[model samples]
Target: MTAPLIGDAVRAPYDLLAWLIGLWSDALAAVGDAFGIGMLDYVFMHHAFLVGGLIAVMAPLVGTFLVHRQMALIGDALAHTAFAGVAVGLFVNSLLGTGISPYVTAVVVAMLAALAIELISEITDAYNDVSMAIVLSTGFALGAVLISLNTGGLAVGINQYLFGNLATVSRENAALLVVLFLVVSIVVTVTYKQLLYVTFDETAARVAGLNVPWYNRLMTTLTAMVVVGAMQIMGVILVAAMLVVPVAAAAQVARGFREALLASVVLAEIAVIVGITLSYRYEATAGGTIVLVAVAVYVGMVLAGKLQSRRDVVEESGAVTGGMDATAGGSAED
Candidate 1:
């Protein structure tokens, strides 16, 4: 078997993305030379930053909706399926002589798994955690079996997929991440209101003339894209954290849904930038480092939220007591 024709179809975009990456690299190299930033001096680090920044944006963009809709686990399910897809791609390449990118296969399998999640929910007349759990398990099991079947040389490379590595970031894969970012951002921007409506209330969205099921499918598909894109740096085990932690942190401080969305993006970007920098400084795993940073951010946000709530309560109590005292004083004067 050969690489899919879709590879040919996307070759032009890949070329364009490569060109953009070159420009970015040149810019980063100049800045690094000026500021003595060692990391920006390397091409792999450039690609790592590029891919990580894009993942930070899209993961939380879709994740806001997922967290609000209580579907955050869907990222995990799709990510596991994507892992299976990676195994499939590697298996094919090993058995045959194709040069297919595992990320490509991961995207396809993950999207299909996304649809399968919706289908399972529909057949059962509700969004079902049990079904999602089954999908997650099955996908992982499939990937494990496939990996065992090709254990001769595949195990050596599998760690990159399982734990992720910054050094493995390649130009072609970065370009693919760019494509996924554009698709996810554009779709979400175009249908922001519809998704917001559905996330809050499917029955209300349907009553207001929206195709709830169709939107559900769209959300899951976007999630699948985000999961695979982030998997490049975050890995299958940690990708879902990118989809939930930032959003949850934002929700702690945001007063409204839109605010939560914007805050999530800002927080995610912070986590990525800080995480990547720290990972480079200490030579830590990118995925684990990023997740740790994100969770730390979440804990900070939670503490801030609690403090704000306490302050509000104190203010309210003082205002009420003052009003009562003023009334009593006025009655005495009367």
Candidate 2:
């Protein structure tokens, strides 16, 4: 039987790396500590503030097409599949004593999963929902098995991925996240016209000679990057909320894709700020708190929509009554 990677002295480099990560995380936490806060407090406040803000900014930029194309569930699928990939990476690193990097493994595996989803959807005449169901169920099951095989305490790691431990993020991880966000931002903005054209009408886009396949793959790859990066902060279980909630909220009022993107970024930023504050006050998970904030925003928007509908009805009724009065006056004059 293979030994545990978590405590393996032979994997000295792994320990060194992990320790370095911990030190950086502490350093970041200490920045907030300067303000008289504890490590956890700092993470809960500043880390969430940073990660949530980044997600809010990017999600809307991509999520406009995702929502328009009815692929919000794709984010959920990728999140869960990435969880399995992380577990597998951990298990393999433990079993092989290779001091493998779980973060790198997660990105590779998740990218493969994204490709698989695309392939299955395109290749089979079968329903996309069925394909998603098969992939999601299998992915979760595999992840559970991998977790069980790990001699080290996989539960805590898994929990961290599922519910998020934003307070414990390392500087390297945060830096990596920032870099990924910048890359995604650049690609999306540079190819904005092509992406929007393809999003609204793929056939037309293709007929116009846009490289639909290449763009599709590029979009999925960008999504994979976002998912992998977010897994560290939001956990796999709730990360999808970041991608979905902002776009949904923006959709309620936004007219065009550009407007929706702007609205999503703004609402997402608000949700993150509100969520972080609430989580700090209630001693809750940062991921869960952020998700809750987004949900609350959506609910408020829905209520607003209902009220607007009622107002429109009243306005229409008054307009009809006024029109009838004008006709009656004209008849009396005749």
lDDT (C-alpha, whole model) for all candidates: 0.90, 0.75
Q: Please, what are the lDDT tens digits per residue for candidate 2 over residues 201-286?
A: 99999999999877877777777778877777678888888888888987776656788788888988888878877777788888
Q: Please provide TM-scores, in order, for all candidate models, with all chains considered together.
A: 0.92, 0.79
Instruction: List residue ranges in candidate 1 displaced over 4 A.
Output: 1-9, 316-334
**197-306 per-residue lDDT for model 1 (tens digits):** 99898898999999998999999999999999999898899999999999999999998888999899999999998999999999999999999999999999999999
In model 1, what lDDT does residue 178 have? 90
State the lDDT at 286 in candidate 1.
Answer: 93
Q: Model 2: residues >4 Å from true position, as ranges?
A: 1-44, 306-334
- Each candidate: RMSD: 5.2, 8.3
